[model samples]
Target: MRQWRLAAALIAMPALALAAPCELKIGAMGPMSGSGAQWGLSMQSAAELAAAEANKAGGIKINGETCKVSVVSYDSKYTADGAAAGANVLAGQDIHIIIGPVGSIENAAVKPVAARNQQLAWNAAYANNALEPRFPLMFQVSPPPAVWADLLIKRAMKTFPMKTVVIVVPNDQTGTDVAGVDAAAYKHNGVTATTEFFQRGTTNFAPIITRVLATHPDAVDTASSAPGDAGVIVKQLRLAGFTGPIGRVGGPGTAEILRVSGGLDVLRDFYWYEAVPTDDPKVRAIDDEYRALLGKDPMGGTTFWSYLPGARLTLKAVQAAGTDDAEKVAAVLRTMPVEDPNIGKGYWTGKKQFGIAQGLFFPFGIGIIKDGKNLGVERQEAQPE
Candidate 1:
């Protein structure tokens, strides 16, 4: 009788396992390799980690059933074409709602595909104004870049009284947008800036640095995406004997600057637009998990900030909607609250802020680069800057 009872229990194990429902598929897209791979990879990893944790907690409860969440990640290669292709592929799948392809460029590419399929896309990167012109089935989770500049300028003015400022920007869409924001902020702060713009891959900075030095500016700012670009720009300025505070609103955090610039000492006195607060328990947990798994801090802020929130929030929306119906799932996501580790908790809406319904709306966090090696997070704010 004892043996028979044991056998019955063993036989029921398979049925119990099969009873667990797996209905929803969560998909993410980003560049997992090449020059822009860091952001995509980090977001993908963070999203997957969140999904796994959610599943361990008995998955998402919807309607009368509990469904397990599975994640699908695609590499957009940081190109619009790659983003579009990934979106096309995923649109053909059974995913309820999609998280991201990290880069603003990728987001722009994928937006149309998402709209066609009635899939809701959450823009996870910084304030990507270029994507503003296109209206799609998407919402933002952060404030715009204009708001980022507003916050930085406000803080800097309070911290240091400045008379003359210089604004340097990359000749890309991002740089142009940030440069405008900085200019307006400086004007509002009772300062006039000497503006200069450079092409994205320009190897020569001596002339531009020399020109800025001759003006004897009190502060300098750049709106470039690449950490190496910002680091090299600052180092070149230092080598040219310019002794002013440097701040890059769009640059990677201090760690990446330190790695590529040979050391952070040469570029110690700068402020960064940090997306996540270092003190947040969630942020710390992510850092710990990322370090444990990858053996390094996630390289780019854009990657982690965009990917994790996109993944987590999208999952929440799917769970809320209770089914894999893309339209309904996306609709639920539009109304869900975003409790992002990076930006704190906020709702994503693009229509009111960006003047377009397809852009992402999210919060921005600020940080300071003290000494030569640390990124001290300042604070998280709901305002755009």
Candidate 2:
């Protein structure tokens, strides 16, 4: 009798395994406890929201079985070592889809681990060139600095036409790249630009403001400044008696900039690359939902819009490929057109630029702030052809 029972138990093991529900784990890794904490937190929140919505709709189908989705987040503290540690932790848990490591340095640290593990790294930040060839599994979800700079400068020239402008950038890799792109864009548009670099943790912009004003520039471009730093620099520029137009050549952070500058009144003649259209009904709905979930307004930057499409694209690719395999999903993504609620419609492109078709090219909105109101203007595919 004992031998017979043992044989029956061994035969039922496969059946029991088949009865278990598959857990599809997605990882969100970025700086959650440093100067860039807000950006990381926003990315994680957006990923969770997407997962929750998918699970509510009976989850995603994989291998002819329904699998429940889960988002696991790790704080990388915006450091190289921290990002590597976080990547290792997620890779150990068999997480194949990762949302972000916002900066270039952090992304560089996590790239090897993602490649070794054959994981998909969906980068919502880090627009430095030559990323796709280095890591086939990595996808750039956000528009690069060159794209935004070109649009902003072109619009500014057509609308305001400043002959000479001053550019302020943070002293970092992203800043350097943004500065170079902005300078080139300005030159191409028949405008001259003088650049100034400030330390990352700079609190006082008086000296920089003084030097910038001394240049007698017709406009000030803070295309590479972080959200907080942009606010400080703009406020100081206003107080220092320079009353020209201000252009932010980076992603939108208007709400935070307004708050940091005390009010919208200080931001006259301001323009920026908006993450979403101000009048898009879909954006309003998502923003309202996000506000309810977080007890505050959504992030004023691309953080609020970048991750949703990535998550949606991942889910769609998994459903289409009928498996959760990273390579298969990535292959599907290369040929898929991504149309999310807030991010609008876009397709993956970059064959000539990055040596791979891994970057999302979408129509981005350019917002003009006048008298505390943000007005949206659309730009169709500002990227190079």
TM-score, per-candidate, Cα-based: 0.78, 0.86
Give the CA lDDT, 0 to 100, for residue 187 in model 2: 90
Q: What is the lDDT of residue 319 in candidate 2?
A: 80
Q: Please list the C-alpha lDDT of all candidates, in the order they appear.
A: 0.65, 0.75
lDDT of 2: 0.75
TM-score of 1: 0.78
Per-residue alpha-carbon lDDT of candidate 1 for residues 1-385, written as tens digits (9 for 90 to 100):
9999999999999999888565566776776765345566665676666677578778887676787777788888767798888877877776546667565666767777777777766555453453454444565544455656667767766655677788887665556666677677788878887688886556677888888888889988865445555666777887787766777655344455555556767766677675555456666577666566446665445446544676676667667777667666667765665566555655545555566644444555566655554456676555321
- Model 2 scores a TM of 0.86
Give the best candidate by lDDT.
2
Best by TM-score: 2
Candidate 2 total steric clashes: 0
Worst 10 residues of 2 by lDDT: 376-385
